[model samples]
Target: MMHGRDDALDALRISDAEAQAVLRELDSVQPALPGGDGRRHRRYAYYVPGGVGLQIQGVSQTYLVRPRNISRGGIAFLHGLYLYKGTPCTLVLKTRGGERLLARGVVQQCRCVRGRIHEVRVRFVEEVDVELFVDTFAQAGDAESGPGYDGGQMLDVLDKLRDAVEDGASLDEVRKSVARLARMVAPRAPAQP
Candidate 1:
């Protein structure tokens, strides 16, 4: 009986190979290192299962599912809904800082598990506001305040850095550009008199 259910799930499953391959490619381009912070964060994220309203392609709809886990790059969710792979959607996340963040993401893969809900993986299409989406919710650190030192500003800097690197800028050039942007955005305090 259980085997039959498993077979049914397999029949409906969407391959995750492509998604994983993309992740690997990104990793090769920029390998993320683990930090020494004592805080324990899950490689996967699971949120309270509920129906979330999503706006996609100028249409609004509700998806019934539970967010399972999230990384800096993407998210995975327990699926019972009928979302298709490559479907573009906007996730409205209510952050701990009492702010609502809108993230544009695309469904990359989906798979069904026997006696368990299906799992859907989504990759963020646009750079997310990390401070609002990750730091606030993950309790990673205190919010920083400086000239142009907001989440949006940081994302812009990251975008510039990525583009520079893709344009064949040397590693030193990339580093210098990032440093200069950081200073411009968040200058240090003036020395005490």
Candidate 2:
């Protein structure tokens, strides 16, 4: 068993040169964004499952990931089983709150730092709808159904919104529906003076 484990480790290891190249590429493409919350809102734990589609040089690939922790800056996946450093991919997260947030990022680093699981770090390369994603997911969690909100339901809502706008439904109607859905999933806090 020990020998098998050693073999697996060796297979997963990346050479130093490869690591450096990956870091260099990431630095060159990473965008300028505030790194999460500097002080008070340091970090937040969120469990959201999503799909990451990679279209690298026309070779398309997709990976399933469950975001373990997310901040304004970036997201960390619990395990990088099939992901590697330097992997450029588009992350599409279907938050529990019925919002689909898209982000362009490259895998900056990944390693099995502790235990046998790997931690994958991605650096954002474009603007992300952090507010909508965060708010929606928070609302979904508070729903009676709990955190296991259906992704299909969210997609259906988006399709309806699109159809409503395309079919010439008034903007006010769309807005009201969106607000109603949000409130149904999660009630908003009272405004401060």
Candidate 3:
């Protein structure tokens, strides 16, 4: 789902085929020696459909980006414009719980892949736990101590709520969204033993 202003994101929006092709290429290209990939940490494919907030240091403008992959040390995202190397940036990644995780980093690489779209890599100043952004099943004593819920579903509902509010939907429509959110947060009944 493209979640930004149509005029702004249309040019940068890439089809699933394009995104997957880039990922496939990365996967097939194995480095001759360990660390030869120039990546300090292993990268995990992050194709989740969402717009990440990109704030360049000393710049007031915040652009939307489509992320491709993530790692403990950094992240790679597709943007419409070419950002200069060494330019500091912060990626605001929204969590399933509607919280934002700020990743501070500097642009390490920005290569044009397709028309008007560039793959930008940013190296974070500090390492981050990959689990924060990626949804994973929680084990016993895990920070997220419960059964995993569908992050996509949550994003969908939140989007609905946002649209309803922004469009000035009637009270009934707002109420319906509230109810849906309530049901999602409500505890489920235990299965019969």
Candidate 4:
């Protein structure tokens, strides 16, 4: 069974007739992608390698998918299954910070890059938990060490530190970042005077 844009709109708690009317109105106008920019929220080069839980409406079970990138308005992921555009779906992201984020969305694009690999784009239907998205760039603390140390590659961390200086990150933020790094890399030394 294929659920289309109508099904997605239906999730908004609107009557079928009203949904049709809205669709008609939308049809009359140049369709701008949700989240603006003629296509969902501003897309960022956020490459967070993590698992995403995907559930297509009418599908009884959930699928584990790998996300390639994310934006405020949507997420793009790679999956083996093909989901038709406009299909209403649920996305559950397990952040590196150990937070689980759930969002309702509709498939916008499903492109087959190679044979069995499908790149799926989903536009969120409602507000998504921002903390989870932010967590993709940072890690949560562990019980042993309180806040966990940086899990990203050292080069990546250095790039961020360089970017902070270039982007005018507050001195306090830089100090904190440096302090965290120092704590992880250095052995017990004399305390700073």
Candidate 5:
């Protein structure tokens, strides 16, 4: 069984170089806001600090996480539970703009900072998800299941499609995505006689 952050990193098979990289990614903790409550002390700058959900392995319930910092590779957040290193978990980050970013990753590092709160680092499994994590744009047409579904999801999907095309997604892949989008927008379209 792993003991501390180092042991956890070892179990994850992360190289010294990778560990160093992750460590450097973390910036110095920030000071508290003036005249604000002392309980709301922020440590680091985060892309989407709070509003992140994490469900432990084999646990049905998901808990909210207070993120510390974010990087292209992974994120370090404050977790209330004792999540061991090398444990598999699902991460859900909701952008300030209200877009959802979901991904699966292993607990690369965990350390007990406070009495019960532990800072946990999770490295994403997919590179594509990492790229999309920072900028999540949902399918506007599929925002809700109903008529007159006017939302930004459609615009987001189009932007993603354009990016995929530029990034060299196969013609077949683009076709499939377009077809899916068409199906999503069908309900909103005027019915033909």
Candidate 6:
């Protein structure tokens, strides 16, 4: 059993050099845009080995993919073959904290980056809380605030908000917490006296 786990870990591991190269490719192709990039949320690099169970042309099959990046809106990955747009797919992603999550989406686009390697983008039916998978709080160079600003506090606020909601906090009480969350995540604005 230990050997099996180790083998799985090894399969998921990507060399630093390869990871860097993938990052470079992603950056060059999808230049970060503040707003009008046609993306509703920011994408974070989240390389991992995942299974994409998809139904294409009435055939259901699962394919192994190399996860490239993820965001609240959707996820992108590298696949070995071409997948038709709008293909119904479900991704099995293992979070940083060793939790497996299933995301259902349809293939939004598929483009070839290199020989026999296709980049497939899937748009989730519902938006996801990216922090659940990637440690966005620990990430550097936040979209709103550049480097040197840590999002640890913001994450704490979010946790509190979720807990309050789950605990059946009153509307007014939740409202106040929501406001705090907005203030923390939103870009800095002029001080309000």
Query: Candidate 6 lDDT, tens digit per residue, 26-76?
Result: 768774322346666766667554332332335434455676778878888
Whole-model lDDT values for every prediction: 0.50, 0.49, 0.66, 0.57, 0.54, 0.63
lDDT measured at residue 66 in model 3 versus the true structure, 0 to 100: 75
Which model is ahead, 1 or 4, in terms of TM-score?
4
Q: After superposition, how far is residue 193 of candidate 3 from its true place, in Å?
A: 27
Q: Candidate 4, clashing residue pairs? A: 33-38, 34-40, 141-147, 141-148
Q: Which residue segments of model 3 deviate by more than 4 Å?
A: 1-38, 135-193
Q: Which stretches of candidate 1 lie over 4 Å from their true place?
A: 1-52, 56-60, 134-193
**Judged by lDDT against the true structure, how good is candidate 4?**
0.57
Q: Once all C-alphas are superposed, what RMSD does model 4 give against the true structure?
A: 16.5
Report the lDDT tens digits of candidate 5 across residue range 1-193: 1121211211223334443333344433432111233422112235443236776678656666666555445677766667878999777766555666666788988987645656798876753322234322222223254532234345545777899899999999799668646754665443356
**What TM-score goes with each of the models?**
0.43, 0.43, 0.56, 0.48, 0.47, 0.63
Q: Per-residue lDDT tens digits of candidate 2, residues 2-73?
A: 111111222224444443344344335542122333422222444442222232223333444445445455
Model 3, span 1-193: residue lDDT tens: 1122222333366665776666566547732112336656655556555457787787656777777777668888888889999998888776556666788999999999767878898999988756567632221112244433345444656887899899999999889877766655555555455
Whole-structure CA lDDT of model 1: 0.50
> Which ten-residue region of model 1 has the weakest summed lDDT?
1-10
Give the per-residue Cα lDDT of candidate 3 at 44.
55
**Per-residue lDDT of 68-110 in model 1, one digit per residue for the tens?**
4465566665544545789887665545465545667898887
Worst 10 residues of 2 by lDDT: 1-10
lDDT over C-alpha atoms for residue 158 of model 6:
76
lDDT of model 3 at position 158: 85
| 65-158 per-residue lDDT for model 4 (tens digits) | 6565566678776666778998999877666475556788999999774555566888888745333465422333334444333343334456
Residue pair clashes in candidate 3: none
Decoy 5 TM-score against native: 0.47
